[model samples]
Target: MGGQTAPLVWGADAEGGAPYVFYHRESGELVGFEVDLARALERRLGRPIVFRQYDFKRLVDGLERGDLDLVMNGLEVTPDRARRVRFTRPYYVFRLQLVVRKGESRCGDLACCVKAAARIGTLENSAASRLLADLGAVALLYDSQVTPFEDLQLGRLDALLLDVPIVRAFLPHWPDLVAVEPPIPGRGFYAIAVRKEDEALAAQLDEALAFLAATGELRAILERWGLWDQGQEELLPPGFSGSLAVSQGSSPPAGASPRRLLTLALLAKAALVTVALSLASMGLAVLTGLGVAVARLYGPGWLQAGALVYVEFFRGVPVLLLLYLLYFGLPAAWAALTGTPGLYISPFWTAVVGLGLTYAAYEAEIYRAALQAIPPTQWEAAASLGLSPKQTFVHVVLPQALRLVLPPSTSDFVALFKDTSLAGTITVVELAKQYQIISTSGADFRVLVEAGLITACLYLFMSVPVGHLARRWERRLASAR
Candidate 1:
């Protein structure tokens, strides 16, 4: 940081940063090359450097926002980035390589649709990611340190694009991970970047770098971290990036082949269908539940008794067990009604019906409570004014009951948000379905976390207005009293 204001410095001492910038398997301390290098730079400048340990991608974004004064992580300077940002002297040499899951392989034009069209996720803010962009592949920047590698370890990503040393470092720990060698892209060195205006400071940093290069201090540090070996050569693992026929995935200008694209399209479309069917089933279930509640409250004793039996049975059963009955067992009943052999219904639709019906039982009780809670005198007064019994209930009782139900309705919707996830058991697609897709296809847990967070936020958004209305009605009622 310049003498003006010491902006926070963000770095990730992760990946194969062992003995230098390694990740603690337990407590997660930031160690390794980037870690020590930042401290060394601080000592030379005679200023305290505020180090923020994070993932590689966050460091890059923070740097772009000027939120970070510097990033000393395993960053590589690339041609695309060169035109956008300024760079410090080469910190170390690292090559990019491909990592694939064990027992899984793909075949294609390597440059056209299927090969080029694969969804490759890699660590954020690394040289390998930069190479991915340069190659014009559809590269998804996965979470830093933890997830990028975890996904690779878990079989989520097609393959990970990582540094030569990093790939080597993780290999001993994960026996299933395989690296693609021989055909490494044009080799490049790692560097720290700053905005163009930081040229003055960049010059100062370059001078400091030059001095470090001359004193063998940098090399000593690198050697200590195990980054530098004999003859200044990087420790090469079994794989190399240079020799492989680096199959570039299809770019925007390089559209993927039709079949692979169609597979992905179908994946997304199926998710939509599941959610749509679930919502439709929920709509029907809500109406049926509402009618049953109203009938139980107002209909003749026999009808009320029947409604009670329906509500109690559904409410007593576990949602999952109930769903199984509807999905697997209801075909016979459906066929009996239709005079067919075994009636066929989609699993997604069945899930919607089961979940909605189960929830509706609870909702019906809430609605019943709303109607019953209205003062009996209000109904009597409406009748005294010559209003019909139906008019008395509708015009006088329903409005107050609706207002009374607002808070519980909010709570119900929150419950609904969570219940929707359960639909995944019966094959209904929603947020949970999206999570499964990300898990099976990319195999990343961050997507699940992200989707869960998004769903939580959606519930929060949904609840806010209801909460507001509850408060507003409470105030209105208090004022009238």
Candidate 2:
């Protein structure tokens, strides 16, 4: 709502990668076609461009929240999107490009790729993903555009379907990869998106676009980026003449009830996965923590030092980094060591082990403190009863320590449940990931809200009961004492 003289704030995801917006390899400067376009728009509009980094999936939400004036990171013009935001005249036209390893022969074209049921990877919630779903091909969705290509090279993905600009920018770096020709049919237009209510801003942006297109400045920018083609010929002449009205013809289908129910069912199923993962991870944490605590407390000096190092190291590193290391780094390291190409662990197990190992460091501290809290009198009493040191520790000290640790352990479990969301980065679609997918593909803002609310409720439903149980146990223990 600032005056016309204020800097125009635009949001984009650099992680979406080159030709759109990414760091240059040599200079490390932020460079892309969109960056150039933003500069041109700034010149035409008489305002400086202020760039803001956003996650690609959440860019629209950022716009809705008034965090950005527009989003220009290769954003596509689609009827569904138009219903939510006003788009300027299309700036660039791109087609989906299919890519496979150089020697791949099973699928030469889109149809052959689909017919072969190739395991294809694409940006999540994208046009290509919807196309793959409609064609019944196995589509793996990723947050970052670059990671999918990495997976393809690692033999984890058979091929990748992405925009032509991305393929063009990245293909050279990957010598073993080649884009399939011709580019997939149908065209998508990239345009700057402004919030639906910003009519004044949208109009101003349209005017700037028209001026850029008319003066041939836009074409020059695209050409410099190697994006200018026949598509721009169709777009430039008619600049800014398009209607702004949201088209009713492209509204979501009448099967809302069924779709909602199915979405709910999928969320519920993902909630179960979250529960199973949390439980398994917590179990491992508890067992590993007890061993570390026992070693630090009672083992030889070398063993105690080792346990201290383990606790300090894991506790210092973030769990998300741990998951990434286990899921992506470990496999790469293993392949380098063994010369085996496909030495990857399943995402679910990788998440389990990563989360388990991370929380164990915290759990060790809790167990160590609880053990120390046990009074010296208890050990003495057990010894007076003719019990051996091991038996005294187990029958007397351990039982009291369990009571002391229960409340904290229960709290840790609840925290661990929420931390499971981080697993999505490694492609384990727990409740949070499921909600993200549903919200992204949903027809309207209402769907985003409803899916979000349901996801939150599911998390509470899983976590609240455990908290209540712990509180009840605390009360019982206080009364008994």
- Compute each candidate's TM-score over C-alphas: 0.44, 0.53
Error of 2 at 282 (Å): 22
lDDT (Cα, tens digit) per residue for candidate 1, span 1-481: 3464454355442322343344232222344556666666665565666764333434554455444567676667778777767888877777666666666556122233125566566766566566568778768785433356677666566666666656554444456766665426456777777777788767766766655555555665665545564423332333322321211111111121111111233334544554465456557666877788898999999999999988998899988787657755576576568876464455566677777778778778888999989889998889899999989877788777777766776576556655666665544445544433333222235434654465555445544665687778877865764
For candidate 2, the lDDT comes to 0.78
Model 2: lDDT of residue 208: 80
- Model 1 error, position 81 (Å): 2.0
Q: On residues 139-227, what C-alpha lDDT tens digit does candidate 2 reach at each position?
A: 99987655677789989999999988777766765788899988887898888899988888888888888767777777777666667
What RMSD value applies to candidate 1?
19.5
- For every candidate in turn, the CA RMSD to the true structure comes to 19.5, 19.5
Show how many residue pairs clash in every candidate, following the order shown: 23, 0
